[model samples]
Target: MPPSLVTIGHATFQSQTLGDLQSGSLNIFLPGLNLGLHAAPTKQWVIVLAGSIKVYLQNNQSEANTAFVSSGTSGILLVVDTKDVSPVGHITETIEQTALLFMPTANGTVPEHRVLHNHVCAGEDLL
Candidate 1:
């Protein structure tokens, strides 16, 4: 048997919007897709409106850490520190042909909501 991939569930979570609220674009990712390791272009929040996605992230502490999110999963993604002295950044993939809302940050500044663990586990845990 293969390792079961994590699937996020729906539950209430306390959160505050980070960036200045403004109109942004909507993106749709198809199914059976595997996106390469990459980072957010600027400080922004990625809201999973439909379907699910798996975020692959690595920081100074560990590698191979992933957060699975479905509809209602949202988080603040910071800029990738790819400097020679820094660790490699993270990546994301559309697990269920996800639809996303890219909420832009204010003046490209880091949001008030800090990325405590360099990654987020939004939404609920799937049973």
Candidate 2:
């Protein structure tokens, strides 16, 4: 499906449905905190609200393989890697005081999206 523009009032906006969310939580982490290698409990949307963090997969935690995201659309990440289907998890390290928004979906369902980059959204996604 292609994205279409909808005019709500005087401005136009792109509208799309991700998925049915179960619940949401706010997670705050201190600087220099390494969450270590882990996988998401379920499928969810992770949004960096503040500061920055480096995320790497369990199989690869190198600086180059790490995925970096900040606060905004570019920071949106869909975590589908679980302990059941996949053995690989992800690692998170806080460079500063980082606030993350965790929105878990129902029954580990993932949203429909085309990844701009490897695992994270690239800047070109805004265009």
Candidate 3:
């Protein structure tokens, strides 16, 4: 059987202080799927909410990727350096919308941090 899924919204914060905070929903394809995190010659951070997702670091043989994260869950802070030019794998929700946060490490940096939060939405709080 397929794995179950859930959804949740997160707290609010100033975009200027937190790099670039933008809220949005995502549709994920299930069954051994991959959410590609392309290399951009900079550092990045990502979080997962709603459904279960598996993170895989490319080019690194020493350490393995992260495990599956369930609903109302949060992922570890990912630090992708510029030297590594591989896609980070992640499995997202298939039916529900996942609120994500993507931000650049520094000014004019290519690779940026992508964060996902797990919190239910109220209707009026979708900014």
Top candidate (lDDT)? 2
Q: Write the per-residue lDDT of candidate 2 for residues 1-127, one digit (tens) a residue.
A: 2356889879998765658999999999999999877877888988899989988866586665677777866777778888886677888889999999999988787777665555444456542
Please say which candidate is ahead in lDDT: 1 or 3.
1
The residue pairs that clash in candidate 2, if any, are none
Which of the two, 1 or 3, has more TM-score? 1
What lDDT tens digits, residue by residue, belong to model 1 across residues 20-106? 654477999998687675545555666778888777665322333677667742433334344332346666777777788887666
Candidate 2 structure lDDT: 0.78
**Model 2: which ten-residue window has the lowest total lDDT?**
118-127
* Model 3: per-residue Cα lDDT over 22-93, one tens digit each: 332343445455455545334544445444454434423222333444444234234443444435433232
Instruction: List runs of model 2 lying over 4 Å from the truth.
Output: 1-4, 115-127
Q: Model 3: residues >4 Å from true position, as ranges?
A: 1-31, 36-42, 59-66, 71-73, 84-99, 108-127
* Residue pairs with backbone overlap in model 1: none
List the candidate numbers ranked by lDDT, top first: 2, 1, 3
Candidate numbers sorted by TM-score from highest down? 2, 1, 3
Model 1 lDDT at residue 25: 73
